[model samples]
Structure formats: C-alpha cells, structure tokens
Target: MDRRHKPSNILPPGEKLPAATVDIDEKRQTVSATLPNGDTVEVLLYGATVTSWKNGGGKTENVWVSEKAIWDGSKPVRGGIPIVFPNFGPPIKDHATSALPQHGFARNVRWEFLGSEKSESGTSSVKLDFGLYSSALPAKFREAWPLDFGLVYSVTLSEEGLRTIMTVRNEGSSAFEFQFLLHTYLRVNDISQTTINGLGSETYIDKVLNATKHEQTTPSLSITGEVDRAYIGVKQDTTSVLEGGSPRFDVIRDNLSDTVVWNPWIEKAKGMGDFAPQDGYKNMLCVEVGAIDGWQKLEGGDAWEGGQLIKSLL
Candidate 1:
C-alpha cells in the first residue's frame, strides 16, 4: 500500500525537481510518506535509505569513496541513503590530489530547497536542508578538488522514522580530510527471515579482500549470501536488529564506531534497473552506520555532522 511517483513536470534522469509529496503523522501510526518518486515511497515508518548500501550495489546510487575508506553509493542515486565524508572508505590522496568523483560530490549534485521544518519534539516531522556551497562547484568541480565545502542534508519524515541528518562543513583554508558512511538500504520481509543483532563482540574490516584483513569473532546472526564486512573498533550503546517474518527493524547507532552488513542476495539485483520489486533482494537488509578510524578532519571554521535515525519496532 506504499508506492508513489505520479507527479511529474519534467526532471527525471538524475533528477533535480518535479517529484514532490512528503507527509508524516505521529498519533498512533498509519501515516508516512517520502515521495520524491525516483523512488522513496510511502516509507511506512523509517525506511530511510532505499539503496546505496555502499559497493554491494556498486554505482547504483554512486557515493562510495576510496582515498582511504567510508563511501558507498556508486552512480545513479538509486536509493535514499548516502552520506560519506572526510574519509570513510579509501581516499587520502597524498593529503589531497586524487579526485575522479570517488564519492565526494555531495551525492552527485543537485540539492537546494531548504524549506520544511518541525521536529525537535514537535512531532509530525519534515525538515529539508541541502547545500553544497563554495560558489556551487561544477567546473569539473573546481579543477578537481580544491577544498571549501558544505553539505547539509536533513530529511525528516516522522511517525518515528526516516530521520536522516548529515552536516559537513570545512569551508576552506587548511585542515580537511574525509571519511564517513550511512549507506543504508533496508526493506525486508524475507531475506532468510533476516537476523542481525548488534555485532556480537565487534571488530571488522574485510571489504571482501584486504584492509589489514580481520573478521572471525562471531556469535549468531544471519543474512543470506555475498555479504561484505566492515565492523571495526565498535563499542557504545550499539544495537542492531533486522529480524523478519513480522516487520522488524531496530538499527540504532550513535557516534558509530563502524558496522556494515550487506546482501548481494540475488545476482546483485539483476544488474540493477531502478531496482524495481525485482525480487527486491528476497526482501532487503543493509545495516550500515560507520565511521572510519580518525580521518574526519575539518579545520577551516570547522563543521562536521552525522546522520541516520530510523524507527519502526513493529
């Protein structure tokens, strides 16, 4: 009963307007929406990230970096979650050099419509803020990496769900390294009936290959197949649950140490094509809320923020 995208005037491809409809209600449930139509549907509660679970879908939503680590949303923006800053995954570029759009273009550009608010406890949420200052970069992006940044994307569609917050500002002048991740894409009803509860004794970093390789300590959890790993140095509150067979999801994260649970599930969504209900991935699951090492250096007037707030414990 959740599916929207009936409003159009133009803009579609990569998108840049012409897809509106957002509503949220918090009285006793039964009211939630996020209709941007590229596909961020009725949401139902807190289905925040629709795609870009970093790399697993590699370039579908384009936004996974590698000057060091922590960046995953690779390509068309085929989802609802992507915010990797400073140095989440790969990319230091000898302090700053390599720039081929390796996850640092502010979710691939087009965000500015700051006009919606109500959520500080005000209930019925709706706050939208998107900015990528620095004279609106795009001249091949200031000759490939020149610093001066500002990306603030705050999307809140309540009923106790879909609260994505990301703020990163290092408006230029020295100190500016990066790395961050929130690449979530969850929506399941199957996927082996899901199962992921707070990384039992965490510490992971095995991007399918090498990163000083590490991952062995296990307890009990399930996904299905072709999953990637990246749980490292985590400890604090930490609560992860994606159950199944009855609409369950509890992904709570704060300050986040690191965590990335993936699912290629079925031939990687058949090479993707807007990733329709195309098996949906047997349903879905991609619990990720990470932070890499130290990296996130922001000096110039300083400004670094974090995001991802989901809800729906039913």
Candidate 2:
C-alpha cells in the first residue's frame, strides 16, 4: 500500500492528509468521490446532477434514483437532484421563457467538469465544480432564451452530509430574470411512514387543486395521495423528513424561500416512463427547495448565489 494510505496512527500528529479520493470516468461522463470515512458521492456531467450519495460507511443511501432512468443523455434523470433554471413546470405563454421547454434547459444540456478541490480545513470533505455557459447550450435552447449567462454548480460532500451551491452570473449587457430550483429526491423506506416538518403555518399553492391557494394545517405533513404543493415564503430555513417518527434527513436551505413537496402517487407514477418498478413512488419523496414563487432579476455584471445542505439523520 502507498505510504499515504497507511493507518493514521503511524503518521505524525497534525500532518495534512487527503480528505477524499476522486475518480473520473471520461467515457461514462461521471465523477465519483470516496472519503476516508467511507462516505461517497457521484455526479453526472449531464445536467451536473448528483446521482448518488451514501453515508454511514456506505451502507445508507440518502439520495434516490429510478432503476429505469435513462442514462444516455436522452432525458433528465427521473430522480436525484435535477437543476431547474429560467423556468419551472410549463412555461407561460408570451413570456421570456415561453419558447423554452418545461423546466428550462439546465437539466437537459451537458455541463463542463470544472474540477475538484479537497477541503483545506483538515476535514474529511471534497468539493466538485461544474460549469455551464450560454455558449455551451444547444442552438435550440440558445435561440429560445437569448440571454448570455453562466452557471457554476459545486457539490461538496463531507462525513456529516452533502452540500450543493450554485452561482449564477450574468455575462450579457442586458439584465434578465429567471427562476431556479433544486429538485431533490430523498429516499425513504416507505412514503406512508414519512412526514415532512417545518411547513405547518406557511401558505402554499396547490397545483393539484386547480392552482388554489391554501394555508397548511398539518404540523407534520404526511403524504396520503397525489401532492403537488409549492409552499411560498417559508420562514424556516431548516426542514426535516421523519420516517416513522425518526428523523431521516434534514434539509437546510440558504437563500431559497420556497419549498415544493410532491409525490406522484399511483396513476401519475405509472404515467412517467422513466420512473421504475411502477411502485417507486412509495420509496421516495421530493422535498424540492427553490425560488420559483418569484423571479430573480440580475443586472449585467452581477451575480447571485444560493444552495442547500442535505444531512442524513438516519
């Protein structure tokens, strides 16, 4: 074995060591990292999506992915963390993003691998960066929304949890407005036993109810049927997903004001071609964090940043 890989007891005190080992599969267009503590994270260049995250000596998987999800870059991965940019859901007619497809093109295009950096704080952590520029977009997407912008997404993994941050910069002379979201799919043993906390007093827009607005009455929201609600202006930055009264995951957001809780349930789950096993809906929940309730306007030469930290409590 390499000397650096030897047991820590044989090394001198206070000596700096590598935090994690990263592997780049150029043919597959994927990057994976393994920390000394056995925590691991994997990212795909397509959409710069985080496809897998495992903690607790690699025995616990906190992120969810569909078995039938296409990996040929044909479509966005059904699960994991999909980036929503410039638009969310379907685009409004006659709007700036009207010509763009549903949820914009951020999750559809390929991103460049910027690189990876090990934490200098002497902690067992690593950060991977990916970049997407306006010039890198396909002709159809570039023509649909002719705005010069650049996005830098960073995914940091540590022994405690995983953190993802995105920086959006306007490279054009004209100002533009856009919507951004992190569609995070979390894994659970059973959706019926899962409850989301910290959204009790907030008001939300229920897309399933014909876009009706209502206040949340349940302190611990449980998924019984189809749900597609966007809780707006959430005051709490921290939300917890509990499985059978035990906290399974804690999501801490920064600069993200809206939270969308969704579960396709029975029929809707079957409708999605990429969703696997037909019953995959019962094993996952989307606790998406975003700023989709309103547009974020950025002037020329300005930049905006936001992110979230998802910690596994299981």
Candidate 3:
C-alpha cells in the first residue's frame, strides 16, 4: 500500500478541511504551493528554478539553496533545481549553441507563469506550468541561438514527490539539436555519510579527471573529494540517494539516460562566489538527471519531452 494513498480520517459533520493553496508573488516573481498536509514548494520565475521544497509538515527541507544566491535576477540562482537547456556545460565550438554561455541562457532569463491547477490524478497535488519562448529571450540570446522554439516546464508537487517535466517544441522549419539537464541540489546532513545507489555497471565521464572514461566498479558510490562524473547509459530508471545507510531520495527518470553526480568538496566550493559558508558543499549533493550525453534532435513542428521525479524517501 502506498503511504500517499492511505485513507484519511473522515471529516465530522459540518466541518471542512483545508484545501491546497497556490500563491503568486508578483513583486518577487515567485510562485508557491502549500498542501493541506503542510508540505510546500516554491519556484522562482527567473529560470523557473525551484528554490525550496519542504515536506514532513514543513519540518524537513529536501531541496538546497545557496545562502548567497542572488534573488534579484542579477545572476543565475546558485542552487535548487536549475534547468539546463539547449546545451550543457561549456558550449562546443562550431555548434549551434557555441555562442551561448555555459549551461545555455535558460537559467539566466525569466519565464512566464502559464498557470496552476489541481492534478487530475485524483491525488492531492498542485501543478504549476511555466513557459519560455524564443521570442521571450533577450535580443542577445535570440541572436545567438537564432532558433524558434518553445519550452513548457511543469512542476507538480504531491505526497508522491516533486515531479518536473519539460516539453520542447521546435517551431522553426528546420530540425534543431539540444541537450537538457535538471540540476537538482539535494540537501543532506553530511557528505561523507551519503552514497548514491545505481549506475554501478555504467561507464562514466569523470569531469574532474580531465574527462576520462572509467567504469564504475562500486555498486554504491561515495563522494570523497571534488567529485564530478556523468554516468552515461544508465540502465535503471530509478536511483536512490542514501544517507547514513538509509534511503533519502529516489530520483525516477523518464527519457533521461544520464546522471551526473557532483560535489565541490573544499577547493572548488571556496572558489565559487555564490557558494556561501565555503563549507556548504558538505550539506548538499547534486544528483542531476538528464539526456545530455548526446544531443536530442527535434524536427520542425515536433515536440520532445523528458523529466524526473524526485521522491523524498525520508
């Protein structure tokens, strides 16, 4: 029996229960949802980045945000789940996204709030939709990419987990290639006590080791130092993050074939200006799910979709 589907106590006569609520803060450009059970999720319009998710009656924070994250849209939010689209990492020379900045411009621009609704799944869930079109891009980015595209990002929060889906529509007359990643920063008590279960038999590109290809021999991986590896061709659809030998988060993917595990450790943590408290790396680990090992080509007038569901196992 799924815990989320368990029957609730019957309401007394003439008594009403609180319903889920969604709030939009126009001044801050943020949207937030709160469940009757006290779980909450918040998103920033800038990049449609999810800044916080608190479950367990608002006592536990599953998502992590940098203390120094710029909230005024001066820079990309340093943590939470930032969308990486069009390209991943540094752009390749001669590529269509070559002129775009690292991780593309999706995280640097503001997205329009499409709307919110109660999920049709018969579960107590709230869904928020955001859209970003090529025309909405700044002139500099529009000129750099020069492709007509539309992206619809949907974030749904329920007792099951936080599910995010991105649908890309190529509105132009020609096919275009792009890479996408959901950069999720998950909170943890300690880095040394955390382990990632899955991708044991997959090959990974160790970005910290000059992009060397290596086979993952351990069934469970731990981050000891500055770790940055992209596990390619992941055979499992679900990966679990364990803390102190207990399951903490389960990342379920759809159409996402790769997983990137990263932690800046010491030196790299101190290097980033946005990463505050210097040692904040010990409290956060990035288990990014995406289809970025290679490009996904979308034909004109066609749409492609991919996403991940981050379930809090706590």
**Which number leads on lDDT?**
3
lDDT digits (tens) for residues 139-255 of candidate 2: 999999999999999898886688888889999998999999999999999999999999998999999999999999988899999999999999898889999999999988877
Q: How well does model 3 score by local distance difference test?
A: 0.90
Give Cα-based local distance difference scores for all models.
Answer: 0.53, 0.89, 0.90
Ranking by TM-score: 2, 3, 1
Per-candidate clashes come to 33, 0, 0
TM-score of each: 0.31, 0.94, 0.94
TM-score of 1: 0.31
Task: Name the 10 consecutive residues with the lowest summed lDDT in model 1.
Answer: 1-10
**Per-model RMSD to reference:** 17.1, 6.2, 4.7
Ranking by lDDT: 3, 2, 1
Candidate 2 is scored at a TM of 0.94
| Candidate 3: count of backbone clashes, pairs at least 3 residues apart or interchain | 0
Q: Which stretches of candidate 1 lie over 4 Å from their true place?
A: 1-84, 89-113, 117-123, 130-132, 135-150, 165-178, 182-203, 206-211, 216-229, 232-249, 252-309, 312-314
Candidate 1 structure quality by residue, lDDT tens digits, 1-314: 11121112122244233334444434421123343323232221122223322121121222221122112323434444655554455455655635535545555544454445433322333455555565776677556777778776655544444556667788777887777777766655677877776677677766656555665566546766767777776564444555553436565565556777776656776766556555666666667776666666679978766655665555
Candidate 1, 56: how far from true, in Å?
35
Q: Who wins the TM-score comparison?
A: 2
